[model samples]
Target: MEVYSEKQQIRAAIDALKSKNLTLGLVPTMGALHDGHLQLVKKALANNDKVVVSVFVNPTQFDNNEDLVKYPRTLEKDIALLKTVSRNDILVYTPTIEDIYEGNTVSENFDFDGLEFEMEGKFRHGHFDGVGTIVKRFFEIVKPHQAYFGEKDFQQLAIIKKLVEKHDIPITIVGCKIHREANGLAMSSRNTRLKPEYKKAAPFIFKTLKTAKELFGTKSANKIIEWVEKQFANHDLLELEYIIIADTETLKPVKRKSNQKSYRAFIAVYADDIRLIDNIALN
Candidate 1:
């Protein structure tokens, strides 16, 4: 695997590959490599002739400075993990912040067509705008034929699909399945930061979602949400943030059963101060 910290060098390398008629795939990520991220790389390797994995902790995306500062950055270990996942020739782009945002970096406002108004968008202000800016930059720089993103960030995946359509970028956006631990917790880089005791209780987030799914057909959305909140209420280690049943497409909160469209349960929880998010289909 070859690693390039400069954009120009990576662009030149990709250009060289394109000269040989190779199709390129991109898997953009923040640097703390985990099994979830490797799954994305595995899919990219299977589909494209060449794959480029970007490992930059984008500062623009973080609304909280502390979260940004505390976000994991094990570049050496991350590269080592990537090496284990793919023996095929791979390019790792690890650009510096200045390399990505050379001059005045203004966060561009994105109209996600009402997709950004609830859940993550409502909670973290300007989070998706920052997501949009960096992703757009990467698309421009990498110019891959296909890009892979994990479904773990379900809402983000939807917004990115909108971003691609809004710009008319000539690339296919592929959403891969969410990778989870044996215990049912969605695999995330932030899982590494959880305290040992909190880690053990973390899987309850998914457990609760599963229960919510089972109760969907019989119970009202309000009733199901109430039960989910009550399940987390007594747990001192787990604090429920928000839980809602919403249409899968519009992401608008659903109050009643709809025969026309599918719905899902979206959730966010703070397990001992470490925030984790998960969602499950309720159809």
Candidate 2:
């Protein structure tokens, strides 16, 4: 695997690949590579002729400056992890903030058709705008045939889809399944920040989602949310942010089951200061 921290060098490399008529797959990530990120890389390798994994902990995406400061950056370790996944022609684009922004940095205002008005959108103000800005820049730079993202950030996936459609970008946005630990906690870069005890209790988030899914057919959305709240009531370390049952496409809160549309349970919990998010499909 070859690593490039300069934008021009990476662009030239991608251009060389394009000359060979090779399809490029992209897995954009903020470093601190974990099993979850490896899953995306593996998928990219399986489908595309060549894969480019971009690792830049985008400062624009963080709503909290402290969260941005606290975000993990392990480029050396990340490169090592990428090497384990593929010994083939893989390019790791780790660009500097100045290289990506080029001094004319501006926040993106996206109309996600009300997709960003609740849950994560409501909680983290201008969070999706930051996400849109950075992702749009990556799309422009990488120009890959396809890009992969995990369904762990379901709403973010939806917003990216909207971004692609709105821009008429010719790239397939692939949403991979959420990769989880053996204990069922969704793997996240922020998981590294969790305290030892809070780490042990982290699986409770997924456990609650499982229970909420099981109750979907029999209980109303509000009731299921109430039940999830009560389940976490005894766990002092895991503070609930939001437990929402919403339409899979619209992301608006679902009042009842729909025969035509799918519903999903999305949850955000503050395990001490480390925020964790997870979602499960409701059948």
Candidate 3:
């Protein structure tokens, strides 16, 4: 329940916890709490003795300024939900733009170049670099034994793992499952932005991806993408961003192979102005 805006105070508190030899876990978030974020908390709490959930909205991560401006922030309700989840010993850090970036500061560059410009990377240029920088800073400040991320953002999970290894951040990256809603749409705070009609129609993205999963063994990559594209094409509310079949680990497009190396189906769609991302690992 204790909130620490100052880095020194937060570190001091972490130091006190470390003195007792309790395990430290960090769950970095952007405030707006949902079942997906809670799933991460549950995983972290189960693994470590002391769980610190960070609630800072890093401006650098958003490729679109309007999207950044519209990103939700509901700290009071979020904290109340955290308490209900039995996560009271949280070290919430909410930093000002100046606190994160000082006086027109030049940020350090991370070499995610090739990895940066593909799929969502191609869609959101320099987005992962922004994610890398903020996450690196969090790792340094919290010095947690482990950091948790949700697998819904499978690509982000992959990037952060590499970032930790490349930078020698000394923290283990743990990924929890992709949480979902009753209708099968991936639970996201942005789901709140969708209109009632669009919300019901939104689950079609998951259905399309799931249908692609069902057709994986029988169909080729191009066939699968086309089928998924057609499904979304008919839905007026849903605007297809990128639909691709790729190797789950590499995120490279999957070629038509009879061997079946377990491809992944990922789709990013915009229902009206609200963007929602979801994916399914082909069986």
**Clash count (model 3, backbone only):** 0
The lDDT for every candidate, in the order shown, is 0.91, 0.91, 0.83
lDDT of 1 by residue, 11-65 (tens): 9999999999999999999989999999999999899998999999888788888
**After best superposition, candidate 3 residue 266: deviation in angstroms?**
1.1
TM-score of 2: 0.98
Once superposed on the true structure, which residue ranges of model 1 sit more than 4 Å away at CA?
none
lDDT of 3 by residue, 109-227 (tens): 78753556668887987788788988898888899999999878888888899898787778999988889999899999898888899998988888888778889878888988888
* Candidate 2: tens digits of C-alpha lDDT, residues 1-283: 8899998999999999999999999999998999999999999989999999999988777788899899999999999998898867689999998898888665778887888887898999988988999888889999999999999999999999999998999999999999999999999999999889999999989988998888888889999988998988878789998899999989999976779999999999999899999999997
TM-score of each: 0.98, 0.98, 0.95
Instruction: Give the runs in model 3 whose Cα sits over 4 Å from its true position.
Output: 105-107, 258-260
Assess the local accuracy of residue 267 in candidate 1 as a C-alpha lDDT between 0 and 100: 94
